[model samples]
Target: MTEIINFRAGRYKISFHILHILMTEKYENNATQVPSSDDTLLGVINYQKVPTPIYDLTRILEGSSAQQQMSDLIDLLHEREKDHVEWLNALQSSIETGTEFTKARDPHQCAFGKWYDSFKSENEDLKHILQKFDEPHKVIHSLADKLLKMAATEGKEQALKVLNQQRKSTLRLLLNLFSAAREAVSSSYKPVIVYTTLNGATPSLGFLVDSVDDALTIDESDIQSFVNDQAIKFAGELNLPRMISGLITKDDVNSLLIDPSLIDASLPEAYENEASLA
Candidate 1:
């Protein structure tokens, strides 16, 4: 079993041991400015006389050059989900009328697919979930050609039944994914800064996230594995490798787990002295 503190950062659920989070509060852009090439470094904050580096979790973890306005994206997703439902309805209607079914066969051509591809490749925490839609989305789009050919031999009624079955299965899955996508973004709130001063002797560090979620305990099995290829590619591309030790998205344990003990050492030693107010 593990005790974890779950939170949202750019539409992704992330968690770490509850013991690591000493306290959390509303972020107040008060970090003392410093010169560092590292973008994740949001400057330092004086906490208990120690210079604590405040990192922008949303900026670094989301794989976006600019932090996404989660609220706006939530509305966009709602509209896209509705568009997909209508897309399916139109396909059914065309099949029933014995007319040409002309629409985007290429998944990337659809409005939703365009946005999906354009979304900066999500970080490891979200890549797996987003990729789950690829096969289903492509399959749904390809249905028109397949069903239209089948209708000539199988009869309109049978073709219509096939379309309905697809609506219940593939389309339903996409809609659920859309809902989860919406939930992921809606989970965000005004940015929060979580401060940690582990055991008094360790360096205090602060993390800026979209919002904080509840703390809970769960069995070790709740921790999920990441795709090794995706993890490696993300780390290699970002160069600012996040020490995301493990990820879990089940029950109340949605989060990317990191060991707080490694946080200070993970950065360049120059960070420790950049703005040492202690």
Candidate 2:
């Protein structure tokens, strides 16, 4: 088995060999400004009395130009859906009798159908939301389905509990998704900085991360090399240095294994010079 340190970057969970880890700490210092030539270089932080350049992991993995266009469009769709759902519920409540509530013409074809139909048209866009649902979306969607089922068969209070939980979950997920998407699209993206050594070198370097997670020792057999895969070859077209060497599977989830040394040569000349002098 190979020991690795797992960490979160944006929505991704990635791992690196524990041997490459120099030290982990809560980022509390502001990095000194650097020239704007390299977009990957975030800034420089003082490490062991030597200035170390901080690189943005997200920006390096996903290019700065990556469009969150799909995410924005999905948000619009969700907002419209929320409004429509609220309207439908209100309309149903206004129908004095249970029979009227049940007898009410199809909302999509009634006198106010145009209002309902508009939302229906927008629903088509949801198919484009995301081919694969992220954790947040999956949880929210699952809770919503359960909420509807419970409301129909179980007590109102019981359903309300599920609804409340969903509301909280939705809010948190929205914030996380929005922040991650924003970072992907924003011109000025600043993430949390981490300090570590390149191949256990003397001078430590700082790199940006979304957040830090637990460390784990994964089985070496679980790691699959990316050497000859067509997809990995296509990833190389992006011209990223030392991006991902292999993927580690733990608990059925795959995490990319990043080696700091892979990107050491890609650091700015000034940073390289500073490391050499140190």
Best by lDDT: 1
Say which candidate scores most in TM-score.
1
Instruction: Tell me the deviation in Å of residue 64 in model 1.
Output: 3.1
Backbone atom clashes (below 3 Å) for every candidate:
5, 0
RMSD of 1: 9.0
lDDT per residue for candidate 2 within 1-278, as digits (tens), equals: 78887776645677778887776665554777665566666567767776777766656666541124334534654564454345335433432222223222333343223432343211222323222224444444344345445656785567666555655666455454444433433422224556667657554667667556767877778898756343532121223434568878888988888767765654556656544553
Cα lDDT, model 2, residue 274:
49
Q: Model 2: residues >4 Å from true position, as ranges?
A: 64-191, 199-201, 228-241, 268-278
- lDDT values for all models: 0.72, 0.54
What is candidate 1's local distance difference test score? 0.72
Candidate 2 clash pair list: none
Q: Candidate 1 has which clashing residue pairs, if any?
A: 13-255, 14-255, 14-256, 15-255, 15-256
